[model samples]
Target: MAIRVTSEHDLIIEGGGMKIIDGRFGQPLYPSSPSTNHIVLLPENFLVSGTEQRISRRDFLSVLANVTRVMVRASYSTEPSAVYRLHSFSMQVANPSARGERRASAVEMCSCPPGYAGTSCEACIPGFRRVNGNLYNGVCEACHCHGHATQCHEVTGHCLDCSHHTTGPHCDTCLPGYYGNATRGSPADCQPCTCPLNLPSNNFSPTCHLGEEGELLCDQCQPGYTGPRCDRCSNGYYGKPVVPGGSCQPCDCHGNLDLSIPGSCDPSTGQCLRCRQGYGGAACDSCADGYYGDAITAKNCQPCQCHTNGSVYEVCNKETGQCPCKENVVGRQCDECMPNCWWDAERQECMPCHCSPHGSISQRCDVEGRCICRPGFVGRRCDLRRQGYERRETRRPVERVPIDTVQQRWGGPSRTGGCPRGAYRPKTGPLTHGITTGGQCVPCHCNSFGSKSFDCDETGQCRCQPGVTGPKCDRCSRGFFNFQEGGCTPCQCSHVGNNCDANTGQCICPPNAIGERCDRCAPNHWGHDITTGCKECGCSVIGSVTQQCNVNTGCCLCRDSFRGEKCNECQIGYRDFPQCTQCECNVSGSDSETCDMERGVCACADRTGKCSCKANVEGHNCGLL
Candidate 1:
């Protein structure tokens, strides 16, 4: 067997097992079990005798047999060949100088009990709990005081705070002064006691107890209370009870014995017993309706004067005769008219009517504002003037005569007698025979393009036809020409001309025209004709470089080769040439190199038949002999 020790008094045994056998034959010592294979323990107080402080085999067996109450001494000691095979064991101490403080001398099992430390459990350590078994055979654990306590009971592990309400080995139960649950896991479970409001302050019990189910339970009640709730007074009493066996007193009567009848006073509130006769109010000191004066003082009531037909009630106000008025009457006696009625001074009676200021004349209307209309007027409220009396101004009548009769009376229709060439008779009066008012012989103020004559019709208005206007019709109107024979013919100005003048009938030319009719070519233009409009000049760039040409004849003034009207075409003598070209005459014998442009004939210096030859040759037959 081998043994191990710790600083906390934990002992450990290791090996295959322990065996005891006979020495002579090497057989098992115990017959039933061949070998003893189990751990053994020794008491903490079992010690050795020498200065080395080690346990002997004899001493160890003796203590073991005594502790286990077994026959271990006989087997190991009697057998001469009995042998013990021990494994090695060693101990590591916290400090070698304090090796004496270690409990290594004691022998036990693998672990030590709580509060005991070192290999043999010989010493008790503070703040550790004994777990699993008694203090002799268990391990040491740190005591858990739940942070609220620093230490606890060594064996039972109860905390120690007197002021705390809970109780138990762990200080976890309700105390005498507190109530509610008092168990571990939760903190401060108990609460202070409070009695119900109906209980007297001095006589009430303040202590409470917790039931097994963790509910609060109160103590006994005071007097005059019966049930478990203790909220009500006992029987034979009406009001709240104050003392033990207490009962409420009866109410009193204030000299009016008739008012002391039953069913009047409330037992709890001590109010009136009953009211007598026609008295009302909480004290029964005032009078009732249909009677006047104080019922408590005078005691004799007087009647009121209210009109039977107009008053709403028989009873009236006590001081005044004012009663509830009817639908159409008011005042203290119920004798006056209502808001919509007026009193008539003469008739001495009330009448119902409404007169709006906008449509009536008086407050007390007779025929709905009896004068619906004023004097000499007829509509509502005298607002309209009467017919046949309307206001107007006087006007005189005018004398008239026919236009023909006025004409004949002035003179006659004859040229020497009647109105002049363009005149007619006046429409609204006798004709004035002369030109004093310009009334006689009124001209036909015709437009330029309106008419062909100056004589007006009988209405004294001028006559006008199309395209003419004026008093004499001598000129054209806006768009017409003034040609003499056609009278006022419509002007046919081309697109280049907008319109003709009224009197001259000439075209109002645009920028492209040079003549009054806009039919001529403009400056620096050529190739003008009636069929095509004027065109820009096309003078040759080399021959007539100026580009300007004659506007009337469309001819160019340049060299002979460039001879067309615009100087842009070649002449006869220079056919197919673009620029100026020299004539191709025989110049060796001719007077000039140029040729006739129309006939293509060359000029000669000899003055012969328009031909010249070399000097050594004969005339027409020079090439033959």
Candidate 2:
């Protein structure tokens, strides 16, 4: 079996996988390549570290394994060198006299471990990390991230950048407010709580948590609201606040009903359920015939002040009390503004919302008419520029992150075999001609037509054909387009910008024109004027198939049986244009058979099929007189 290193902490021996057979700490390492994004592991000289387990070369090559991020430290080896050779004292040279013999020592061979190399076993290889001790004393071990994360801390082995809603030192559990089995390592193992009255904009609860029985529960309801979903109002309130545009207001009983017990007013309407001390009326707003003064109002009956915020408040009166609400409010002691209207304190009025039609989420605005803008746009009314968005910019395509482990969403263990899909362990070779041959198993990202080949180097840098740039060879250089295997062709359009369709080499057309060079008129217009575009064909519906035209003559092709310039009339011998028919007149008795219109003695009456007869002719066809 062949073996080689493909990245800073990975190896490839079989099955096109970038896994590590083994490694040790404190090896002298240099930068792998310019494009690899690998760091200078260590200086030319480094320490010789220890390890926990020792394995033979056979065990290392047979086992499929992996190594994660690590660090390199320095320490000197203290072992003394030993020579193992004997010298002969015989005068083998051509000097036959009694001459002194000179001796020489031979170099010895060392058989170090799989992770070590050197005449004296002084340096350790990569794929292992050690935080303590120098090379000769510290140990190195493989890193694991519990399948929930792809990477971990270099110094510590803690998992980082957790996914599938997991969080912890090892990503072994789900985060707060989420429930389910996180240890299963599946993306759907954990999930959000399904609240009963849940809404996209108005979730009345602060959070939903797991109950004692492991069931999801909405625990935190806002003030004046209660229930599992914060949908119901308290004893003294009314209205279905759970629904959109609904709010809970205090009972408008005017203090005529006793609220010591419960059910003093209607749950939806402000009408009192039961009046107190001979009181009667819709909200008990007036005393009964036998009742005395001040039965509806309290002893010191005064207006209960209100806290006018953006949302619903507690204090309230009847439907039309007109208590003069807060700055932006007008509901009888209510604090919230009406739908689609914002308060204008300077003018003391509620004006209709004026938000940007394209940028704002809705017409509703804040007290200052400030709208909630969409992403990449910002302003009080969602109309101002947001830096890079000042000019119309095309949106870039989105690239998704690669997943290392594959697991079932519903259930089951993870599936592991090699590097992530769309990735491969590149072939290993010496660096040559400013090109990196091998380093990592990364995505083979290259343009189909712009690159020389789809195969990428270890650092995922594709080889471009010529004028193609970008690491993926997806863009053309010098404002060129129509990229192909050999190179990119120069753009031919007059209004082309930096980019265009790389494969077609077509020009970006204006809204009113379309063609290879944006010189042709649109389908519904007819003219060469790009400024005003093509004028609308205005083709007669009974004549045109496209209901529009693109011809330079500014007219539509007439349908069968039609002849007028606008195609609105029938042909010479026919009557109804859309449902035209041939004229059949009696030839022998008629004056002429050709519907002669040149002299103005019109034809076989176009509408009646009657023939114009000669002199002495009287009957329909001049058969009798």
Clashing pairs in 2: 6-439, 7-439, 48-135, 48-136, 49-135
lDDT of 1 at 579: 39
RMSD of 2: 53.4
Q: Tens digits of per-residue lDDT for model 2 on 234-332?
A: 667788876766767778777666666677888788678876655667777655433333544352333434444532444344332334455455564
TM-score of each: 0.20, 0.25
Clashes of 2: 5
Off by over 4 Å in 2: 1-147, 154-158, 166-184, 241-250, 253-262, 274-281, 284-625
Q: Worst ten-residue run, lDDT, model 1? A: 15-24
In model 1, the number of clashes is 38
Write the residue-wise lDDT of candidate 1 on 1-625 in tens digits: 2221111211322211222211121223333334433322432322332232445454454443334222222223233444443234433323323647455433344465555665446334665555554433456665554433445565666665523466555555666656665654345666665433323442233566655775545565344333333333322213344444333434342322242354454545555545455444465455446545565665543565566655788787764546777766778667666755644556544556443333234443331222222322322233333322432322521212234432343333424225665445455455476523424454445432233333566654455544555555555666776433213555557544337676665667644556767777776686555445577776677667476777766566776556666676665444445633433444344333344535644443222233434556444422321
* Top-scoring candidate (TM-score): 2
Task: State the displacement of the C-alpha of residue 518, model 1, in Å, after optimal TM-score superposition.
Answer: 86
